[model samples]
Target: MSPKASKPLVPAKTDPAAIRNFCIIAHIDHGKSTLADRMLQLTGVVQPRDMKAQYLDRMDIERERGITIKSQAVRMPWEYAGETFAFHMIDTPGHVDFSYEVSRSLAACEGALLLVDAAQGIEAQTLANLYLAMEHELAIIPVLNKIDLPAAMPEKYAEELAHLIGCEPEDVLRVSGKTGEGVDALLDRIVEEIPAPVGQPDAPARAMIFDSVYDTYRGVVTFVRVVDGQLGHREKIQMMSTGVTHELLEIGVSSPEPEATKGLSVGEVGYLITGVKDVRQSKVGDTVTSANKPAEAIIGGYEDPKPMVFSGLFPIDGSDFPVLREALEKLQLNDAALNFEPETSTALGFGFRVGFLGLLHLEITRERLEQEYNLDLISTAPNVVYQVTAEDGEVLTVTNPSEFPEGKILEIREPVVDATIIVPAEYIGAVMELCQSRRGQLEGMDYLSEERVEIRYKMPLAEIVFDFFDQLKSRTKGYASLNWQAEGEQAADLVKVDILLQGDKVDAFSAITHRDHAYAYGVKMASKLKDLIPRQQFEVPIQAAIGSRIIARENIRAIRKDVLSKCYGGDISRKRKLLEKQKEGKKRMKMVGTVEVPQEAFIAALSSDEGNAKEKTKK
Candidate 1:
């Protein structure tokens, strides 16, 4: 019989001991998705004729970029040693910005497969994710992937991986995700090595909503992991955090593809649909329980992800403000970390100041907005949140540089991060020099093996927000990997630089920068504006200023009419009279004329902040 038409794989009361919940954790481009495809095939969840690569990556962007953005869960039935075992597998994103997704997935699993590329070995994000898994106390099974590669160094990296995880080299499993070599053995190991989930199946129905996305036809689809009891289709449930109740309309599992199931029991993962249209009703990290006999306590361990970078997202057309708001609301339903609020700029008019986890997140969000919503947008230069303390002792949180206080300021604190960099031993000097140039303070260093070294530094978040990763890659020849986390705020010599056209400040062009580099920033902005802004009827001076003092200035020559051409061979007095008259007219025009900045100029100048990161990522 076809899998879909067969009886529910999850029986009404299956043995919890036969279920193993786990997720794959690795660095970017390390074959996480490739391995997932192999497992799905081996389990027969997806028919061979219908199989495709990166099967779990459903979004077009994910397939194009060759990166996993969202965490995808699947349930597969494996027949091993004369018994059928249900495997709940979650494939997570490896990028540092999406580490929050990995954390949420980790909370719902009992084990993690730490996959390391045999050819490339361990990276910065590898250690960062390892720490996260360790924090959750999950059983980590080290696996070396890409054993089929010509440059595969399984023995070398196996020892390195084992050393980091405090395991013997022999314990690290080896497999080629490309050719399916040793995949069957790997699946058997998963069943033998990983422990089954433990929970009270007879208790009140409780599940944790790890993720949720809005469906246009069916409303909100929530992905949950049953923690203590069984959740049946058509059962009434209540969200513990919000106290909102809804009846479950459909319940199913994604066996590489969505298939209807009778219900999900403890130690199982599946999707729940309540047919609710409001996106706010279903939230990630919220606990779901039976409305009639709800669990006594809510499942509360994970914290909401905080946005580390802030940028203003303004539609090119002013009338699209409401549409932009709606797009952001729907996007937020899919991305819990995204945050935005209505903001107005004198130059850009109506827009929203959006917060993102990092530069990658910002870029992805912008692309989705333009592609899916069909709205033209102009994004301001990204910045970090700053804490400003005034002379009156009141602290103000400033997400946009335009919101910087005008009065006397006591101190400005910028967010700092604890950065971890892993590179070859030969490039240690280049890495250290680059870090020092960005105002990084050395914490410590350690040699993971004979050739690999790990360096730690505490650096300001602003320094690395733009093109720091690109620079590091160039300096180290694309061998260095980086991961960082916010480590509170540090008081610094920071000042807000304002770009003024004529005498008016352009709030969209404002930025908060270190006092030491403020002059250079001012000069760059002044010169850039000089080239972008067209010549007006009267000379328009572009100046970059700090409070009352101008640090840099440039002038756009006026477009003057030639009155002297008509006075050829005339007396010097006649030419002088005509010149004076023209000069007087120019002065009057300067006094009343406003400098009109073209939308193209604003778009170019604002997006210029992206620099090398944009180019490097594209390649």
Candidate 2:
């Protein structure tokens, strides 16, 4: 749910050229949000006492985690050179996982404040987003922040950033977002450097929906950027892509609070209420235009996002399926990128095959489900979409291992990605070794500066989904930044390895791994499962198999009863009789014993044995 507030609207100065639309871009903890707070404070959009840390981040999860999961747009009035300038600012996330959020935020703006930490220099996310901004043809104003810190060396970092982005180091602006220094000059530079919004105001209304959230009282509150014409209150509007129409209820902008306005024109960023109940009707990237006088062409860049990772989400109680479905429906209303459909596992019963942009996105969705709805859930191991080609040239995309076809005539093509890592020169060797161990092919290496290097590699999406980031952090001492993008598909020698509990294949515990390394992984996984699964009354055999070939096996020892505990010293006949009786009882129990695998066991068995087992063995 959106943690938003409603307030009165102070009409913004609507002249398109007098308005500047921009967003703050930086690395995580590189002062993106802090700089936004300073800007809001300086412009008097938020009072000093009313201002708090991460004032733009309204979500409790966002503030507690010190990250921006959602992009926030606000309008502020600031006077410079005897004229009041209206600034439409977007505060974007700085993490690689939320790169899509940053992209959407940038899509709404004509310029971006390219913030770089004065002490940390530049990072992976910083470069990734800088490239994104360049792709959007947005003007970037380089700003060095956190100069108040003792470790800050603005001149040195400025040169580094200028060298990478190909700008003059002297042109870089310096600021202390924490201390509110150099903020005013930065605002002045935005006007002089960033271009004004360019669009035909007399044309049909064309506002791009950049972000949205479902409100408990208002339904879908779509955040939009007005590129052409204007949205009038009580006018019938149409979604350019969906062709669905809705009556406009109200229009407004965010001033860190939702404010109602009569109408919004070109160069304005605001939210709209259409009285629409379905969130899917108003999606990000969809264009809102006048129904009566629709535009000739739909706004560009409205394609749906592809899910990078997929997993099974099952309710612990089978009766809770309806409740789980309702919860997912509500969550998906706000998160358009989230995809799910009904799926069933032999062991997990009925569930949903949920797809997410990345691992972190999946993690956040699950936490919200459990926390917001108070439901118990189990998630299977994450996997990526695989292309399975038959001899007849029939290609099918598969995300679940249980759904992987047998005797599918031809090769399996797995998604591959072009990965980039930025690290200190000293740790280059270690980082390269770690990447190589994950089956990454070294593409190239560049010396960004005397002390930093940028390494590029081609890696399988499966490897990236499973512990690659954690392993990289371990090797680089958390000093390296990694970024990746899908690079189509490649043929691979892959196999589905299934884990069997007491001779029964547990579909939820299966995974796809490289054929050559499957046996070793199978062995590690079998042993790990043995440790995780509780001891049953009878021995439970844990096995990993590829097709009918069993690659590895382990057994969970049974809980043996000391029947002789009550026996007196050396009564051989009595001891023998008791042992025979116990043996008979064990045989009977073994024939009827059904090992119940715990939920945690399924999670542990399907995972790569990193910390729980000898991860070095895989190397």
Candidate 3:
């Protein structure tokens, strides 16, 4: 007879329950997702072999980028102390650009698992996110991860957490997400230490929509944390902002695979299906109340995030303009932080002025728009917020160069950013040199460990706004990590360098440069403009100037004769059509006096290579 199969042990649901609503918060690549996987395995939520890396990062883009773009929620039934509990785990985005999304994820939870790298300790972004969690009054369970690494220093990290968050150092949990050591104990502590949801569930349905994104089939999926009462699937709900009422079609707790639950109670996070045709209708932070029985309105729902970086996104091909616009609209449905307005350029054709949270956010957005949507885009140089005072004493915002007042006889303020860089101690000297070259002032330095150093810098936002992270990575051989925060505007000696093609000013090719590097930057920009701007019918003089002073000049010699002077037999119509298309293309180009310039001239003129080349040639 076959041996009787042993009965699988089932966790008891009575007595001390195992349910814990919590989220993991950490800086990018500090092991938040890795630790989450380990937690699932330790709790028997997923087998060790069945587990995949960043399982919650289900989006194709997220998997390719190895970053969590959207917050994810998972339910794991675990047993501790002879009682079963449902652990609702939320994984949040680590980058500061998605801080708003992180806040929304935190609002849905009663507690947080603050994951700090044992060797790296607290970073600037980590501290920033931790503060956001504190504001929500979420109970924090500090965990020091990466403890298995040879350089791990759990005790020091514990002390840092104690100092930074006012938590006890001895009480900090040290666990190796890689080796899965001490993970089981951390799970037990989460059930024992974290407090349960306490809001009144019998009250009228009042849910807070923290973040939302558009789906093709699902329409709008709004992530809400029920503050009071209960929300069930197919229940009628009204949006406080727009007063639009709809029935919840489907309800889930997270993205990708939402748990098809009946209802979500107080302090529970879940998604609502309102059949919202547009994502803007279910705006993030909008209050969702019952149409029949409403509760006290949620005031000051969410402040509109101010975009710091601005740029123009145009299509490379003029005919693809409509496609680009549609792509942007689709992207906006998912990304609430992205702001855009329809714009047209003589050189770039149709485009839009896009606002982003910061430089990284801008790059990521552009990359996604192109890669995900399969659209070719021509992006103008990124710009910072500029405060300009008019001649009549009226202040105006100037994000684009064309909007700048021609005769601003007053002060101009440029955005400043607080930057932090962490690097191996051996590369400290080189890193400091590069930062100083970019006009960065050393604020202070903290010795993170015997081999690593964290340096702080107060830098002009313009200096490090472009390619600074790339430069830092290259100099440190990919060992350095950088994080920055906008430090408001500061009065600076700034001048706009205009690059002229064929002795005529191309407004789009202008950039604001520091007075110190104006000449060098101008020369480099002029050279690049020459290379990118196709040689026109007439010779184009690429000149860079600061106000009335000419700083640099390059000449893009015009094509002497592009037309075939000798015509062949029986090909006149085809050749004529080709010539007509070329003429139409030339009409799209910006004609600056005698020469015709392409759209790429504006972009190339803003590059550092042109400036560097000018410096070399001058020397």
Highest lDDT model number = 1
Name the top TM-score candidate.
1
Q: Clashing pairs in model 1? A: none
Model 2 lDDT, full chain set: 0.86
Error of 1 at 344 (Å): 1.4
Per-residue lDDT value at 111 in model 2 = 96
TM-score of every prediction relative to native: 0.96, 0.92, 0.83
lDDT of each: 0.91, 0.86, 0.76
Give one clash count per candidate, in the order shown: 0, 0, 5
Winner on lDDT (2 vs 3):
2
Error of 2 at 454 (Å): 0.6
- What lDDT score goes with residue 94 in model 2? 81
- The ten-residue window of minimal lDDT in model 3 covers 8-17
Query: Candidate 3 on 224-318: residue-level lDDT in tens?
Result: 77777777767888888888899987765641245556677766666777777799998887888888887776734366677878988887677
Q: How much is the lDDT of residue 169 in candidate 2?
A: 96
If ranked by TM-score, best first, what sequence of candidates would result? 1, 2, 3
Better of 2 and 3 by TM-score: 2
Which residue pairs in candidate 3 have backbone atoms (N, alpha carbon, C) closer than 3 angstroms, thus clashing?
18-85, 19-85, 502-541, 524-610, 524-611
